[model samples]
Target chain A: MDKIENNKAWFLVLPVFVIVAISAIIPLMTVVNYAFQDIFSPQDRYWVGTEWFESVLADDDLHGALIRQFVFSFVILLIEIPLGIALALAMPARGWRASLALVLMALPLLIPWNVVGTIWQVFARADIGLGGWLVNALGIPYNYTSDPVAAWLTIVVMDVWHWTPLVVLLCYAGLRAIPDAYYQAAAIDGATPWKVFRHIELPKMRGVLLIAVLLRFMDSFMIYTEPFVVTGGGPGNATTFLSIHLTKIAIGQMDLGPAAAISIIYFLIILTLSFVFYNVMTRMGTGERA
Target chain B: MSLQLQGIARTVGGSIHLHPVDALLEPGLHVLLGPTGAGKTSLMRLMAGLDAPSAGRILQDGQDVTGVPVRQRSVAFVYQQFINYPSLSVFENIASPLRLKGQERGAIERRVREVASLLHIDHLLDRLPAELSGGQQQRTAIARALAKDARLLLLDEPLVNLDYKLREELRTELRALFERRGAVVIYSTTEPIEALTMGGSVLVMHEGRVLQAGPTAQVYHHPASEAVAEVFSDPPMNLVNVEVTGGTARFPQGLELPLTGHLGMLEDGAYRFGIRALHLALRPKPGLPFLPARVELADISGSETFVHVHAEGLDWVVQEEGVHEHGLGEPVTVYLDPTRLYAFGPDGRVRAAPARGRGG
Candidate 1:
């Protein structure tokens, strides 16, 4: 059989290339351009050549925001992964109850980000809100508006409530895809419930668990709107994550050159972290034991 | 250990899956021979306590264990699909059951290696199930079951997923393995050759009912009904409808044979005559009754030949040893010794004595 070399097939991909260039490449190149130039006005721009990059890199506020972003992502991951798995395990395996549980678990994920933040803000208000009244009545001084620690706890709790459902849904799907034979075999082998979970359920959910971790990490790392809407990045910057800080530099302070440089660095950090995570997870998933 | 099923039945979604069944099984290899959907797996599940019977109780050692959970019972079930802990190496997979029992690590390793070597998989211990072939994965599953040393081992067509050569090899190994093990082993298969080769008691099942059960050779030679006969033959039992008037039964082609033995006692009416493929000889022998047939197709499978013939509106398969060629649409004469024939009444129940007799 002769191999067919059809160069005309490239014509079919031309539209995709055009769309990507317009939506992604051109905007990225504009950011790169802005990162190197100091603009006094629309027409009075000068080449700064690494000056903005150096200043952005040396900024202490950006460093604090970076560390806070890391801490937030790591903490959320630690809570959500195990909680999601437990929720999935406790869920019904069949019939109408399974369907009902899936729908209820998906409710938080379906709400818009701003709406979630608004809901939490009003719900956590110290005055006239049930949650605030109940917490204060319990004698734990609870006011997110003035206390940095309270504000930080509220944000973390809100984030978990909003995003842990995504992990639960993923892990649930992974759990459902396993054939019944494995469970039957385990039962026949006199396997305890914990052993069955450790040997069968957890291993089978590895792929989806990795996917959940990656998605939650990226989403939490780039988190902005919820905290902005709730605390306005306040309680004296207790929850001003990387996205909010970048926005403050670019839009609030009107420092485009340094903001663009900071944006580029932030993008690199996320890319490197995601790449490292993906490689490590895939290796563990397919690795052989000696 | 002794296992007994007392009127056990299963019904799923308002349809009967297994009719009420009663049987006592001792420790040995017992083949559940039936076609697919014959309630073999359902019955096995009830005995293993994986599923509760809708009607009756299951007893082990004369004690009722019907409502007991599978984990509490000393039983192991191997499904047709090869199932293993995919992330665990073969060693760990085999040791999982022992570890679950809280056995010491040293004893677990020793038993795992023993079963692995018994199943000829010792060298592949470190490889995960995903890295092994279909046969090796099933072997690992069986070895795991053997390592558990459960009192009752149920295998539901465990070799149906493997290639032919691998199935043959494992069948021999399993036959030997079950013979030595004290556990009550119940193996199910749709293939008659497997039942015959395993050499144990055979339970012939059809349409959710047990048609017959006895020693493998006895059941093969003396099936209790037409269903049992069909379930016990490979190319299937060739059944021809015949009319009986006096002391002789006449075939559709006007050939007559004397019904002088136990067949003589049956009422004169429409009866079905069944003969195994191997009993239908290709050449005419002296003193043997013969039937004329038109060859429709001849399938030669190396050592054996199956000749499909059409005669008097019925299709007949004749098995001949070695290579025998018959051209399509050719008229041929096939001989049948009347003593080896089976007589069934119009209701599909066997009438003649099961054992062979000298030609009269």
Candidate 2:
């Protein structure tokens, strides 16, 4: 076992290690530098210490964006995970229907993220798109560009359409992995379809669902493209999410020191939660099957 | 009610259709034996009502059950894959049937424990299937089925994954258990000994067709054809690879085996012969024919000897339990009952056609 550790088999990972460190570490140092020191120009700088960090933390704009991010993550998890699972269930397990459903789902995910934003941007405009025209035709006085609730709903709907397929794909794989014998046993047990889903399908998918939840949470929290394109944080900052707000402060305001501080805190929030999710999922597997 | 399949056929994957089959079964422990791709599992599936027949109908107690859903079939199947809920504890797996019917908690617990005890998996009730050994998981799966209280039991090679010794012991116990309960069992297996030991009527299948169906003893003693004879033992009942010509069957290596007995299917001339190694008695038993031979080789099983013989210009093999005095190269005249000869025609069918009608 000791010799197994010393096998310098790490030679295989040496190149990967170097690449990751170069890409991740170098940018991280730059962020750290801007976080503590004021960079007014290319050649002039002064240390602002925690002044910018405190100001950014105290700003009501930051508070509002943070709340929106949290709510968006929560709402997406609520809607997408279950809806995706339902879609996965209704999908045929094999044959033409299965492949067709897979291809249809895959089409959405294959579109680039920015393209997704542009598509939704045009699709939700009342003067131009079918969806906007339908809502107006229904006379609900809906305007995603001008109304906060409409903007939030539009963003959530766009995210679901774009990402629910990922959850469906994962859950579909989990469902397929279950051996037919289990269903045979369930049939013998007199389980209705509902009981089988609750007692078997639900538990079997818990592990994958956790992963899906964490991924969707992270993606939804850091959402910057679609909402940004649709509203551009517009109608007086009603649709402004945290990442979009951060970009405005960091790039639009050109205040690197405060933006850097805000970004570090933002990174920490994601890092902490993602770590917790990963730790919990891995530990659960260890306590059970292994 | 006994499970019955009369002229049932099913096609798998839309392209592969099995031959139409008929099976009249009794309420006893029946073991369906065959080789790979023999449609044994498909037969069990039909019996369990998990599948519908494409050609003919199934009748249970004179009731057409061809369209009965699996849940209403009153038949329990223990699948070969041991597919219990991996996330549920052993007790939950066993109690699922009771729980599904809204059985009182106390009664569910008692029944689950009883079935668990019967299958010898009571101690592992708290553990999930993934936490148990292959054998233990298999027992939980069996226990779950037992607790279901179905009228007919269909086992699709349920113990195939078990170690050899455990399989033998469990099979023996299961046979007795099913018999004592008077529960009809339709079991499918790829092993001949399992069918014989279970001691039900045997249905020998080959390539989606039942080659022979009868009592275990009858099928073993007089298999309908070389194809049926192949299901009798492992590595199959070996053929001498000789052909009947004139009055004698000749082998390439300077041996002429006389046409010891006649079969109707052989066209007055050429054919092949087969015999189960176990059925070839070493010592003469009253009316049994003894073939003169030498011990060419011995399969040294710890408790039994399987002797290979070169006899009368033909090489044949026999199994002798608790082999006491057999030595390789020792000249021995092993017995073969003339009445027990299994002859096959050139077209690979039982040489003897049904003399009158079907014989029981």
Best by TM-score: 1
User: Which candidate comes out best when scored by DockQ?
Assistant: 1
Ten contiguous residues minimizing lDDT sum, candidate 1 chain B: B351-360
Off by over 4 Å in 2: A1-14, A39-51, A279-290, B12-16, B241-249, B258-268, B277-341, B347-360
TM-score, every prediction: 0.89, 0.85
TM-score of chain A considered alone, across all candidate predictions: 0.94, 0.90
For model 2, name the residue pairs that clash: B265-B351
Instruction: Give each prediction's root-mean-square deviation over alpha carbons.
Output: 3.6, 5.5
Candidate 2 lDDT, A96-185, residue by residue in tens: 989999999989999998899899888888888888888999998788888888887888899999999999998998899888877776
DockQ of model 2 vs. true complex? 0.32
Give the TM-score (0 to 1) of chain B in model 1: 0.95
TM-score of chain B of 2: 0.80
Candidate 1 lDDT over residue span A91-114, tens digit each: 999999999998999999899999
Model 1: runs farther than 4 Å from truth? A1-9, A39-47, A285-290, B12-14, B253-267, B277-340, B353-360
